[model samples]
Target: MGIITGVIGHWGWEVEDYLLDVWEAHRTPIILATSSILICVWLYLYFSEEREGLVALPRQYTVETKRTSPFQLSNPLPTTKPKVVGEKATTVGPKRIRGEIPRQTTQKESPKRDGLEIQVLVFYSSLTGKTEKAVKDLVEVSQEEINGAGTGTCRFPDAQILDLSEIDYDEYFINPPKREDGKAVDYFYLLLLPSYNIDTINDTFLEHLKETHNDFRIDSAPLSNLVGYSVFGFGDREGWPTEEDGYGFQAKEVDRWMAKLTGRKRAFPLGLGDLKMDGKARLLEWSSGLIDVLRMFAQTGVLGDGVRGSGDADESDGEYASDEEEDTETSIEGNEKPTKNKGSIDDVEDLGKMVAPSEKAPLAIDFTTYGKSKPVNIQTPQAKEMVPKTSPTYAALTKQGYSIIGSHSGVKICRWTKSALRGRGSCYKYSFYGINSHQCMESTPSLSCSNKCVFCWRHGTNPVGTIWRWQVDPPDLIFSGIKEAHYKKIKMMRGVPGVRAERFQEAMRIRHCALSLVGEPIFYPHINEFVGMLHAERISTFLVCNAQHPDQLAALKPITQLYVSIDAADKESLRRIDRPLHRDFWERFQRCLEILREKRFKQRTVFRLTLVKGFNIDEAVKGYADLVDKALPCFVEIKGVTYCGTSTSSSAGLTMANVPFYAEIQEFVEALNHELNSRGLEYGIAAEHAHSCCALLASARFKKNGKWHTRIDYDRFFDLWEERGPDGDWTPEDYMGEETPEWATWGNGGFDPRDTRVDRKGRKIEV
Candidate 1:
């Protein structure tokens, strides 16, 4: 027990001695408290300094201990690098933090490096000029920030601004320049994109970016070859906070895309300005912040300082605030005035004057109330009359081998007409009319026709119109003009061996006028008068109408023959074949036939069916017979297509397939004959012109005692026509029965199609 006590006392003495030694130290509490306070102060200062320079880097990476490459960070000073015209700029050699001072290099400065300044390029796309104005303001403000002596070592002394829409993509991006050291240097890009529809990316800028970068990924990517760029968008706030509704989404979208493409080191935070508010002020604010970013990049070569906080000065335009106040005051005044007007006695007195006025013009009268036609409004005449040019029409006609006559008429020497001139033969019309083809003057009063027939022999170059708005030539002038033009054409054939001088002289007499030249001859408003003039000159007239203008046809005066061109048998076929300008063309065609039916007995009414092969030929025999029964005309002419080459007017791309062979035409004609016979129409093939690929169908009415009286007695017709004058009465039966002379009959009359090697007179040339 004594020994334990002695040990315990010894431990206690050692503890007391240690406590006495601690207490003997001088100012121990004061020293400890001072040290603690100093440490806390140092920590606060260090952390606060760190926060000022902290940057929000991309989420993909964090800062590490390793040094950064030169391209990633700039040192305190860099020897100015010269720009070689065609060389590339050098990239970073090592990756390091901006705080890490790089080893300085000593080298002789190249002459090209002298006066070289860092460049900033601004591209903007704007529709309402707001963004454009903002861009101008930015340039004006940034000039001071990036340039001047106060910019220190980070100043960009030069900048170029361009409309994003106008830049050449290749010269800027594809062919980027290089420094003399064979390294590619990148310039900073400031893009101000104005969204077209609030949320939609600016198409002009997007397209420009797409065209410049072939493989720039907007969504996901391994970002390589990053080019430092910043973007902002100008938009309006119409809808917000919905899945597809927002303002400045385009700005966010572009910012995201740039990050994915070039990484956050090269992309800056999106800047947005609402165009609906103080857009100019917001834009200036964004620019001011962006300038700091540019300075950081120029000085440190790293994106260090984060997005600028709103502590910066408000550069908002004071004029805008004043304007808003004025607008508010104006609105209040406008409201107060309306309220006063409602209560004022003076306003009530003028209530009648405030009532809306009637729409009727002063002194207006309605003539229609008295059952009179509405008076035509006489507008002031045009300063210059529109004298329609016949030249372009004439040129197109001539290019397709037509001869022009007078201003509106045209003449073409048909092969048959030429054949007859050389004594070879005449056209089938000659056989049907007892007229000489060579003496038949083919002319028209109007060259424009509205119908675009698929098998048109004129190759569809004939100009078309609904009305006669053209300068007209008097019938006398046309008669004389046609004679002169025909003779001139005949004179050109003088040296040709087969052209008979006697036949040519006879051709000049002009005994017959076929107004079937290349147009709807009946479209001429003066057609009836023209017919009277033709009969006056003792010229037998054969006028061909497209059957489109019925009123014109119904008003026609009697001629030796009045023919309607039938291109298709049914309504569908008619639409497909004729391509008529009138939408109600089928109805118009029916009305035309009704007119023809009424006039069938007045004139030698004929239906000239221009049969196209593989088109209106199959099963069309029935359709043709139905039409034949409708009008019960004196004759029906079926002619095979002579395939004219590609027509200026759509021809359904007619080829040889559209053209029927001679045998096919004969088969179709025979089928048509059987159909007509079965219908008890008593129509029979009168004759067929083999060389012409045409057949004639004569109605039983024209068969006098089983003999066809198809030929017109030209002299008797002229006598009747002249005797009756323009207002005279006449019928086809008046001159229907002159025996068709053998030479003017179909089989023996015109030139043969099989004998195409005929001379100019249509006589088969013996080899």
Candidate 2:
């Protein structure tokens, strides 16, 4: 054993020496390889484990579940056991795993698949209950019509009337409502809304519609599923005459919003009715039209070709096209044809033909040469009628309740006249100048004017010209025609509700003539002859003229009273307010004031100031005072501008905000009174008609013995005119009447005691 151990030990020592040499040579490479392998293993393990953790995290934290229904209650019953005092706690019912509560599935019945039935939902908002009643009537009529239609594949159920104030907007407006009975049905929405300046449910409903259309989280046209929609509005034309003036404003807003929500599915044009005038007739027409459309839809499942409801084309496109065609046709003379390009001599000749006169029409006469130049029979182009029967202006005027008499004259029953017939009230003239409103005739001899006032109630439809260039109608024909038309209008009012029997009879006899119905009355060349016709019939005339016509004002004969409208204080303001066509309008206005100053003693001259809040009310006191200083008139009638609610007024930037309130008018009158007094002008506040937002400032000449003598004795004035003729040497003082009534004085309300004050619904208002 010792020998074997010795041999092994010797071998081991030899092997160790060889191995040590080998380790020293390869130890560095082996260490580097081992370190690189450890790093690779660590990186693989770290990244793979992280990936595995991420993949497993959702499984641990979240449980797969169905989507919760929007109508489902979000709150679930508690599952945890409650500990009772002095009692052993036990697990309640079943313990729910956290984040593992099973979603209670609410299987809402899907909307019925059948599309053969139509469900019409009539919605309305009423302030004074008129619209509500109107809706009821409309629904009844619609149901009858639908019943009359024979049963077919597409049947109409009874229309449901829903008050907008009572219904949940989300149930219907957010999206078309599904029938609770799970019946497949299509919906047609109809809205009848009354407009009010005051806040009402219509405002809230309109706001919701607007917000729904603009919401980003929901579909913009969520209600596009609706079959169709229509809106009708009721308004008072006497107070709010046009849409631009806020007449049926809320209805317009609803129509606009519904058009957006329904993907431009306006089933009908927005229908508007004046509540006091044509509400029932207009509503019946709209309802009939809607019923016809509904029947058509049921039969064909389409709104029909070229129907407005089927698309979003502009309503005015056809009219605009027609106007363009007319313009093109009128530019070409006689039988001449228009060329696309004017490069040829033939085209040039065609253009020259445009200036030539037609042989068929009579040559225009030069009336200005009657006195100065010799009368020459020139071959000028024939003059067109001031307002032809077929013209759009004539149509527009007729629509606004005016009876166009002959070619140039128009007559209409003023609101004040209607009020007096109803025994509600009279005009400011009744309180200030002793004129009976019931016996007054408001007519205009000329339908053309020189200026386009922003507040013109004509809706900018009246013809405007720098000079008279149309066929002139004789004064007698105008006189007889206007009286006949005026009488006819008065006779129609006899059957109206609230028209007094005695007043109705009295209204037949025209006692006074107000020449300020519309347009510049003095624009008529035979204005003096017209005045003579009125005076001959013992009718007192009140002639109102725009200050643009100085020459006409100078030539005007004596009348009961002369009024010159002073709309603005200076040239720039005048341009903005009057929008006169004549470049020398300011010069003409100044000259008219000079002429008025001369006629102050001979006639009862006055300055009428219509104060538009934003345009002419502020810082214009001194300017108006300067005008008063220039005119030196007998009276200064100040009134707030009446908003005419038209697109033209809106385009001119005039809004309801531009109309001054009665308080503002009062403040303006006070300021003017102070300014006039400061200028040594003996003018005092003579009267006020608060209902009309008008105040009168008169010269001291009209005040006698501590009372105002502003009222004119009409009989005495007529007698004086007949005795001394139009150029009589009599002064205004000779015809001044008794003292002004106490109720019409500066502080009094100016409402006649005999007439009962009434609200819009004709209910008596307690004093």
Clashes of each: 26, 1
Give the alpha-carbon lDDT of every model: 0.58, 0.73
**TM-score (C-alpha, index-matched) for candidate 2:** 0.53
Off by more than 4 A, model 2: 1-381
lDDT of 2 by residue, 1-767 (tens): 99999999999999999989988999999889999999999999976765554422232233223222121223333354333223333333444423221222211221222346777888988878888888898777678796554245567878899988899999999878887897656788988888988888988998999899778767676776676787888888888854456888888788777866765556655677876788887887777666766776665554432222232221221111222211011111112222222221121011112222342233232223112434222223665687788765564455445778888888877778877876788989999999999999999998778787887765444666666777778899999999987875664453233444446556868999999887788988889999999999999999899897787899999899999999999999999999877777788889899999999999899999999988999999999999999989999999999874555567777988998888889998999999999989999999999989999999999989999999999899999999999897999998999999999999998998778777654567765
Q: How does each model score on TM-score?
A: 0.48, 0.53
**CA lDDT of 274 in candidate 1?**
69
On a 0 to 1 TM-score scale, where does candidate 1 land against the true structure?
Answer: 0.48
What 10-residue stretch in candidate 2 is worst by lDDT?
Answer: 325-334
